[model samples]
Target: MEPENTTQNKPRGRVVMLVDNGVKGDSRVQKAARSAADAGWDVVLFGVSPDGEKHSWKVGSAEVRLIPKPGPLNPRRHDMRRPLFRRPLAYRSPQVARYRVQAVKAWRSDLSFRQAAVKAARAGHPGRSAGGSKARLLVPRVSSKVYSKWVALRARETTDLQQRRSMLDARLDRATTALWQGLMKQRSWRRLTPNLWDFELAFAKHIDKLKPDLIHAHDFKMLGVGARAAVRARAAGRPVKLVWDAHEYVPGLPPRHGRWLPGHVAWEKEHAVFADAVITVSPALAELLKKGHGLSQLPTVVLNAPVLSPGPDEVAGAGPVPDLRELCGVGPNTPLLAYVGGINPVRGVETIVEGLTQLPDVHVAMVSVPPGKPYAATATIRKLVDKLGVGDRVHFLPFVPHWQVAEFVAPADAAVSPLHHLANHELALSNKFFEYSQARLPQIVSDIRTMSEMVRSTGQGEVFRAQDTDDYVRAVKAVLADPERYRAAYDKPGLLEKWTWEAQAEILDGIYSRLLPDRPRIAAQPSGSRADARA
Candidate 1:
């Protein structure tokens, strides 16, 4: 239930939400902004522009602005490129020095071999010995013995030099790797990947101008941005509240680069303290984040559940929700499985495609890749399907609007969440899990802890070993054999109601209300102040 807002009649406050994505498919941020707006707060959601250009739009009463954050300061590509904020060339370019040393050693090795050959040749020559014919002949025999020894010694020395050269190369490579890892372990690792700086530079000025009473930073990248902006507001005597919404555990995420894990962990550690309140996706994640950050208060768990609609057969939105079965060109009786979410290796999309080969009659609607966009995983999935010779059985489709996902995927016989067992995957019930439940589709989920336990406890569907093709086939066969039995799980009263964005939004509203009670607020920028002058 939504906490009673004692400040309901008071003037609504302005909120500036900062996220790190393009905001096109980010449902969590979209839902949060929309919920805040619906609760009578003026909301502006700022996100990084996908095409390095500005974009503006509206999500319900909330305003969305995509700021173009273009520069060499991307964490994914930071270490690969020349450092954006460079150190001294000698300090930065160790590869250059390593290569130079290897080249000189190679040159010296070659020169020694050549000089030894010349000396051996000279020693063997008869004319170089000062003596009579007998002595000359004897000298030739002795010189030949000496020259042979020299040749043997030189060959061994050359082999040793080459081996030493290889060892030196390997040593240097290890040294380089160690140096990088060491630097990332330090307190100032953020300087190496200055992408956060780029984000701050892009959004901070806009944040100041908005004069927001609250700053909602989505994920780790924006945590610092929101904190700095909140400090700026407070320093100017505006008293803005900061909320950090940690989407996932930083250490649990797949590291994009060598410095990605440690750098982000340190970054979040520094800025998370500034947040007046924290919001997270699941109870498990909330507990982990609380312990990880050692926060004064545990984070509020706001699930990424779909917004509940009035009718099951129809969506509340205006757009046409595509039929998953029709798109696959399969009839209602056909065994159809729907997989909704982004296409990635860890998502275990390959397990679903591979499993299709065993269930020949089964057709799958892969809503993996986004519409009209090039995703690398699309090709990977296609290659796997082609290799397995299941092209005709699979259908590739685009994503529907966030609110329509449950309705969009409802036509399929069952929904599959074959997510691989990663730390985050094991802990949380994915949005698709709730969406499938909302659609009343029997779930064929992976054996990852949370979703699997839910599936077993609720008797919603079958749980298979994650990434195990044979186990997935068995689970699919079980569900297709008696999907209605699994579907009956939805018949339980109020189960669907508990897993919804509306229910999650109530928790969000309460968090906002508790953080910023009934009070008068100052402008984010005061008149004749430096912030106003900059604006």
Candidate 2:
């Protein structure tokens, strides 16, 4: 079936979005694609595939093109063994030992295949002696098993050493991170640039073929990609526009080796000059991008709010929706605290798990989508839950579709955001905050500027000291103590209308309309509205 929002008539224009991550879990990219499609634009999304296989499929109103990376480097063909040889011998973790065993098996398999090919080629050659060919084949047959055993032993030793070093490095990560951050501050910003992965390079080449009228870069990583592609297209006489959607404060991102925040900030400053327009999720971040990047224009703020319900009754009656509670085997009266987002370290998931130990009556259902990195914080949180003996109180639900998130969360007594006070978290206005409002559920948020202001102004919930387990417990209890007072805040006239994505999407629609003034105009629709629910 044709995806929702896609027109039977010819599209007004084409827009290609460059998303570094896959399209499945990225709500921002999904929203952008839907918005563009609703406005009569044919949308194409370029993203990564886990396996090295190229493929295309329809996702809602957009065409998704996924490019995969090459498989692991072969030790025989490349310098992969050089690094292994350099490591000092030491004890190995069980995980590392198993990996080394697999690597050795693969290496031996490759060697066996090569030897078989050589033997086959000798049989076909006219000049080779039968005796000499038999000897060559016999030599490998006799020594191959011994050689494979020797290689396996060496791999185990090397992997053991690497695993030991990894353990040591983990202990010193904090000190090393601080030292690296200090060194990065002194280095020339010009020297820092994002290393383009093979898939990204392939994506850039693929984009050249599309020659889209507009290019929408999802986050900082794709800013340069989109800008460069637009420049190439414009140089070829195609009038292409570039839109940068800065999802977070790039300059204030957590410190890491090589790709420091300052370096990324500097790189983005240079690339922003190429963008025809800039877009961001929150007003606080928009202002930061304007001042930090020195953009000619202030970025339009497209808040990641929940889409509006069909009517007031839908919002009010959502609380009684039958979901999660029965599936999780929790009582109807049990105070269910819902947290819907990526379960990452910065989001303070550990604190939430820890705090649940103190709140015996309340249950927390973590409806988590995967973060940028696979299982970045989920493993740690699981370990903590087991250690704290709070497994019964803390439930984990697999990520649901964007439209179905409301149904899952609607049954909760309250929504929680115990995010740590990192630079990005402090200035952040996350989707969960508005989602709680949309579900008419009270919020329990971190005592940060943006979310605190939201709760205080709207009178929808309570905020406590960020990263403090006791404070979080108290804040959640305070809200649950008088649920009606907090619930009444969401019922205030016009509050839900303001927080809905239907209102927020208008800003996005306006930005595109202004960017392509000559294109045909279509009435903008909310992403995942009834007509587009099939997405």
Candidate 3:
């Protein structure tokens, strides 16, 4: 650990990070942890714990704070929703006008409910004396007290639900103090998207408490928490350096899947402008931030790949990869094609399935994320595949831990990323891109700018023209036909090589050593949404 600079003149910065639900139970989170610890920075990771732990706890060298997990893993107990009491949306929207409307409505509703209930009682007891009304009264004192308490409790509970609903109605305002508290409480955002954000908050809170020199937030979902945490830290006069890693294009999130209603572009646009340094996983996204977003001030682009070597195992949440033959009844020799990660429309797993149906001899295995996740288009695709008559050939392993993903892919004849072109996918440098490369395996991927660039650079994969089923079909068939070519591709050096959390950690170590040296260091604004132009 870097020695604290107790010298009066020496400045020692203390950084506090908020990791959100993602940094827990994820290899990337572990990688972030390694980066912080290796850099000799004190880090507290606020996120939920796996297997139902109570209280905030430390994982490895970093603290892991627990946030309530969302939803029933069993599914039957609750649909993809929070209990009414936990709703953030029900409270009010973030927009002043809409939020005020909701707030006023709530105030009125609670007031009216109490007034009406009391008025009815008073009218019913019109003949009661004033002294009796005050003392013995229209009702028993115990009963009145209990009834008032129940009414107040009911109103408060109802308000919580309304707040959650309002939060959703207005679009999830992640870049604020309000969003994360829900995940920590399981009262607001946690109930909204349990799997998505619960752990992210716990990690962020712990990060905030530890006061590290540097903070790394991966992906857009966690960005809000990281930003909010930084904002809070700075407000408290803590100095922290924040590294904002963009795994995918934020504005491009919709339309890759069936679309989940709509969200405000301003939210992400504002966030993009607000980040300290916009680190992108893909060059394409870097270009987007530079060109489209007018973020002249944001220091952007420190590209990354998923770590190839063993990462933090505690967060990996993986056991040995499930045996496919035993689980699926498929012979060990059966040719398998695999697609991992959120099975959303942008991923184009449906295209992979259709393309595979053309090949006929291959099977498709989806190892990450279940079809049932509300956000996944996987279920919809499954029904479509059944209609297309290839249902049995394609299967889902659901969300395997990051550690076991390679296990699922190892048994496959090929891996693929058949993504639909979008701002998000166009700028995406997906984890699976490097995951396949680290395994030294051949892959078929979308011809999106970022993905194609990787395939061309690494020579480890074939690029199917974007969203073209025939292109996917041909690519897979060619790999199946030419084992030598596949081997040739796999033998080539990958961008995935020389880029592990270790290397990133060394860079981070240097960053912290220079930035902090003794005590913790901090950025002017620790993290999130730094626009080049003043906001």
Stretches > 4 Å off in candidate 1: 1-10, 72-186, 309-319, 519-535
Candidates' C-alpha lDDT: 0.76, 0.71, 0.55
lDDT of 3 by residue, 181-214 (tens): 4334323333334343333444554555455555
lDDT winner, 1 or 2? 1
Weakest 10 consecutive residues of candidate 3 by summed lDDT: 526-535
Top-TM-score structure, candidate number: 1
| Prediction 1 TM-score vs. true | 0.74
TM-score of 3: 0.60
Candidate 2 clash pair list: none
lDDT of 1 by residue, 1-535 (tens): 1122222343668888999998877888887887777677778889989988888877666678988886656523322444323222221133434454455556445444544555555778533223334343455455555654554454444444334433323454346445654676534446535566788898888889878889999999899999999999999999999999988888898765555566677778888889999999887888899999899888988888987542221232345666677788889888888998888888999999989878999999888667676688789889888999999998988777667788888888999999898998988788899999988999999999878988999999999998899999999999999989999999999998889887887788788888888833322211121111001
lDDT ranking, best first:
1, 2, 3
Cα deviation at 187, candidate 2, in Å, is 13
Sort every candidate by TM-score, greatest first. Answer: 1, 2, 3
Candidate 2 per-residue C-alpha lDDT over 410-503 given as tens digits, one digit per residue, 9 for 90 to 100: 7888899888888888788887777777778889898888889889888889999988889989998899999889999977888887776768
Alpha-carbon deviation at 15 in model 3, angstroms: 4.6
